[model samples]
Target: MSDHERKQLEDFLAAIEPNIAGYNYSTFSYLAQKKGNVFELAQGRLVLQGVPATSESKHFESPNLKVGFLHLHELKTSVKQFIESLLTGKLLTPHGELRFAPEKDRSHSIYFNPFHAEGVPFQNRQAFQYRQMQLHIRGDRRERLDSLSLDWELKAGPIPFEGVQELCAEFGVGQIDGDSSTVEIVAFSVAAIGGESSVTGTKAKLVINLVDGLEREKASIGYRLIERNAVVKRGILSGDALTWENATNFQRGVAELEVTGGAVLHCVASHGGRAQHHYWVADPATAQNPFRAIHQAFDKNLDVLQELVTKAQTKGANARDLEIAVAWLLWMLGFSTTHIGGTPKTSDAPDLIAATPFGHLVVVECTTGILKEDSKLSHLFQRAEKIRQTLISCGNQHLRVLPVIVTTKTRDEVKSELDQAHKNGALVATIEDFPQLINRTLLVPNAERLYTEAEENLKRLQNPSPFDVSGTKTNLLQ
Candidate 1:
């Protein structure tokens, strides 16, 4: 073996030390004294003989009696025979069986529980004690016996020390620390058997203890023979249906088995935890779809703008709200916006200035009342001029400016005044047309074309009759 493989083997041996310590110590103490260079366990049948009592003797004895001990060879043979009887006997469960054979190299005798047809071997040696049993298998080694170990822990549950002792006796397994609440059991190990390295089986037998209440006043035993890797369609199972007899695999490598109204999920493979047969309880809550919840929340927020429009008090405030809403809409459409309408020192500034995703700037001026033949038009021009100067100072070469008037009045009602303002080089739109204008600008394929269309639309709104060229092109020329 390579150095790394040797280290892994050493680690595996170190981890299972506690499991076999008790058995090794007891066996060593029993056979410590040697007649020659070796010592062995012996057994034989016992017989009693009688000796006759003498008149002068205080102790009575029967005459013509004899006692004899078996020879070492006979003793060894008898012991082996007894052990073979025990292994093939009904002492172990029907699902358990023993095997004794010679190692492949014929260097040592091999005796072990060879139940490879059973899933992973989870044997509870001492049925009465609160203990845990585990089987660890190493899969990397192909030749020779990969390490096989059966580990046992005692008093590993809520049961008291005396309770475990009684259980150990009931189960017919030796117990240590009879008075202590917790103890460790002897572990069993075997070198690999010939042609056997991986676990192969299709069924598992599970035994569980049920307590009636928290105080543990009453208890009962329950067992289920389940398929090794079955997928449970329903996590719950009735008492009679909990068995490997009717189970089927849900998917390759994964299996589920019901336990106490829940489930025990298992993953089996040829390597890693799966190779060693690891299992855990499946949680039901993790099966929910997360995106469904997100979509529900998204649909709920889609009508928020209409709700805000219905609840506002004044037309001016309503118009301002719409402007801010539109600015946010532009931001969501991949633009950066600044709301300057409410800043006292920047009153001449446009209500909003935004940088579009296509690398152009847009300035907007908003009004809640009708734009008539009055100072409102001059104020719009001043705001537009301020925005133009700001963009020029920042070295912005391409920009679009729009004057938006959101009023209760219809488009026809302010057509004359809107026409006059447009002649003075102001791009204007009423409340009813604002949304359409924004949509058109956003949907256009080219940013330059969007600005060009806005300018042409403004020119189309000018008076057809001859007018002063200087006044009409005032802001447009700049």
Candidate 2:
């Protein structure tokens, strides 16, 4: 970092220190709105609209006030890009320099602290608003005041993989493990989604490899200390390629750690003047065998989502696995699905056929690669049309048959071909939509609702926008 930039960061940190000090001020709220053009990073409650930026207090009072700002130019590029920059340690803030962390620093106060305890009064501490808290009935007041600090935790919900992937590609994380081709960090033996009951002593173990020929001598690595799915701590790991084990309890409290699980180990490794951000996730342990039945696998295994996400990200290499996982997910979403591609007789047919009880049906095709061939869309559309005709002939004219293509590719990766998919009357579900699909399965679990959602998404994709280049959604629309 340049001296000017360093000074600016230090000044900003100093200015915000009072706002972040004390127990009451240990955490802040972050929100991105206006479709990512505007983001609020406030030490107190963040209001989206009508929050005026005040000169006297920097932060707002109650009804409407926010305390952070980014240049229009900075946000115009993209919100995800901005976040990726921050995660990769490119963006400097009050916390520490993201790229560097002090060795053995369990308190990652350096990573990012919207909260700082420099000038804020000890008496002004915000009670019941901390990630990790400890209270002593009797202690030296001066000593207690002198020892105030905050641990790193994510106030925001889980971050999507797309953001992490983009960061790695942009900064270029060098070789780890044996693969130098791209970001290849993996988490083994941990549940990808959920852990066992809180009483059980099943601990989650994570193994990270920093083998020979690694471009960087040291990398900043950290993990989300989780209780259930909430992050209790975000601490730095001290060694290279070490096996880290989860604590059975949070600071020896009643609340068990890693139970009902969600955990992530993040690393920012630099090489060739670029730093890459990689994540390894583990869900908590479950009693159900993941290899049993499709439904059992989805029900008992906490790692189902991660497994599916991995398959989608890897795509072609594990194309068949992706197909089966999607099919299984559709089934869990209350769809009566037929795995057509699984059988030799229907190998040439659409990959899967999913139908709602109310006669809404989707002809599904799974792909992990490009979808540019005219013949491919034509074929999917034709098959769907044939199915529609067949239903009409069978006196089910009210039935709906929608051709759908599911791919692990990102929306930008398939943007150019979206018009073709729309032209062919096909609903193209990219990697962006997969998570929502799974979330809907958990949230709604109604086939009819998902069918409606698919229909709506298709319409939205096919429709023309009402805004021009200078309009509100021109650049901010996700």
Query: What is the lDDT of every predicted structure here?
Result: 0.32, 0.40
- The TM-score values for the models, in the order shown, are 0.30, 0.41
- Model 2: per-residue lDDT, tens digit, 1-478? 3455444445434432222211121111221111132222211121111112232221111111112222213233322243344424233333212121112422112122222112111121221011111110110111111111200111121322223222222222211111111111111111111122122334444333222222222432345544422455665433334333333211000112343323322222222222222333333233221222345544554266446656556524556666887787777677888888777787678788999979689898877776654355667877898888899899998988888887766565676787788767787776555443443333224678667866766666567566532111110012
- Candidate 1 on 1-478: residue-level lDDT in tens? 3455445434533434432311211110000011233211111121110111111111101111111222213223322232333223211112122122222332211112111111111121111112222221111111211112101112233332233233333322223221111111122221101111112132222322111111111111122222222343333222233221211211111122334322223322111111212122222222111221232255343244333332222433555665665565445444567887757787666677766455556666555556652355677677767667776888874655555434323354465576566666765554334333322222212334444555655565554435543322212111
Find the candidate with the highest lDDT and give its number. Answer: 2
As a TM-score, model 2 comes out at 0.41
Q: Residue pairs in steric clash, candidate 1? A: 19-187, 51-61, 51-62, 51-63, 52-61, 52-62, 52-63, 53-61, 230-256
Q: Which regions of candidate 2 are displaced past 4 Å?
A: 1-294, 297-299, 302-309, 315-318, 373-375, 465-478
Candidate 2's error at 410, in angstroms? 1.3
